[model samples]
Target chain A: MENFHIDGSTYIPRIDFNAETGVLEIEGESYHEYTTEFFGPIFSWLEDYLEESGKEITMNFKMSYFNTSSSRRFLEILTLLEEYQNNKEGQVVVNWYYEENDVDMLESGEEYADDVELTFNLLPY
Target chain B: MGYMEHFSVKTFKQQLAMKKISLAFQGIFSQDVLALIGKSLRNTPESRVIAKRLFAIVIEMAQNIHHYSAEKQYSEKDGRDIGVGIVAIAEDDHHYIITSGNCIVKTEVPPLIERANYINGLSPEKLKEFYREQRKAPQREGKPGANLGFIDMVRKSGNPIEINIKEYDETRSFFILSVRVNKELQN
Candidate 1:
């Protein structure tokens, strides 16, 4: 399996996924112009990885901020992971990291959690 | 009150004038205006922050005009909203005052007024927390409808949000929010 890496920015987060440990880390602000286009490849990569490798996956997300477009893509990613888990290929866990004092981010995670069958961890960084 | 208020050429002219209020983003009406505005705003220390927030807020506001305004027009390449509105930025003794005004449906006024109240009541620290809480919660019933853009703009601006609402009609109302970023807090 190949890992994907993205550089971080003030307005967007850097993403790094480890193929060995199946641990994916996304950190940064996430308002992007080209929404699904930017994430399509990442989603395909993950889907293929889980389908072929059948490995357990865990993702750690530390985002300072993100726009609604990005938020939609995040859910798409989670939905993809849910599919993988439901298929029984492997288990996937999502750990959402935000500042302890940041209530909006926590609430956002909870909202996303409500939709997915998988569990999401709300962690303070 | 009249349907023409929504389409009056004057409305667009005023919005354009408000654009000029920020020399950095003003005089930008071209295929590359967004890119140009981005470049100019990116050059300044304080304006950079304001610029990004503007990107999000304006998009939301423009969308609101497109969807809700009881008017219609398609003159601009992007079909700029026909809603009567003005968005402005000015400097005062200390902070930069950012203001935006537009006609809204009467039904839309109360929630926004409540939002403005909620935003003003919080301190910077609390605002930050509110932002996090909002982010962590799943999106409201619909994603686009969530008021995160407003909250995010307030959080990014680092200023108290002030709002003014008046009746344009029994069915339509005007809404405005202005905030100042004290000079001391800005670099």
Candidate 2:
């Protein structure tokens, strides 16, 4: 499968999904207007990738800021990964990175970690 | 209060100035405009925590207006209709007050007031629980705001949302919302 990559902007995150290595990373801020439209293709890509590959996947989230709607989308992504891991398709490891001083981001990561059964790690940068 | 007394532009302007409002904008709340406002807030000299809260609140408030305001404006940049509203940030010794006002259909006042009152009644933990529950639930049809922005603003500010609804005309009312973020960090 081909890789998926989208550059970051002032209000959108950068998406880099490497099909070969199974490393999916989203970094930066996400507060765009068309959140559902923007994430649609990314969700489709993940579903297709998970179906095609049996390799272990690593997901990295290094987000500085994201609005409420984006927060829901992120939770959806984590839930999808949890389901993948639960079904024994392959191992899934999620690394959620936040700035050391951003307590809100840190708390958000903590909450996400609590909401899913996947191997979630909260890393500070 | 009577319609004319609901919002006096001169009095409002004086109140904003007296409250030491640092930034104010009145126009279409397009995504581009929201980004510019975010940039300005980030550049403010407040502590990182306060700045972050301010940024989040501003986005939520502006987006609410963009989605639900009764006033609409066609934006050439966005190639679509956007909401028109007013937003301001004022600072005192202990708090930064973020206020936003927009026109809304008179019929929307009851439900909006109910939602605000419900959110204001919740404790911090309950607010967080409510936020997570609503986030997990499917989006309600035809409701883009989803009340998540309101919950989030209150949760982040750790304060009750103050709302004022005044009849603007026979069919429309003016809705004003203010959220206060303590300058000192809360545990």
Q: Pick the candidate with the highest TM-score.
A: 2
TM-score of chain B of each: 0.64, 0.89
> How close to the true structure is residue A87 of candidate 1, measured as C-alpha lDDT?
80
In TM-score terms, candidate 1 sits at 0.55
How good is the docking of model 2, as DockQ? 0.63
Q: What docking class should model 1 receive?
A: incorrect
Reference-based lDDT, each prediction: 0.63, 0.89
Model 1, B37-120: lDDT tens per residue? 344545545433444554545444443443344444544764453444555566655555666666677887788778777887
Taking the true A–B contacts (Cα pairs closer than 8 Å), what share appears in each candidate? 0.08, 0.49
Query: What is the C-alpha interface RMSD of model 2?
Result: 1.3
Distance from true position, residue B24, model 2, in Å? 0.7
TM per candidate = 0.55, 0.93
- Candidate 2, residue B110: how far the Cα is off, in Å: 1.4
Model 2 residue B88 distance off true place after TM-score fit, in angstroms: 0.5
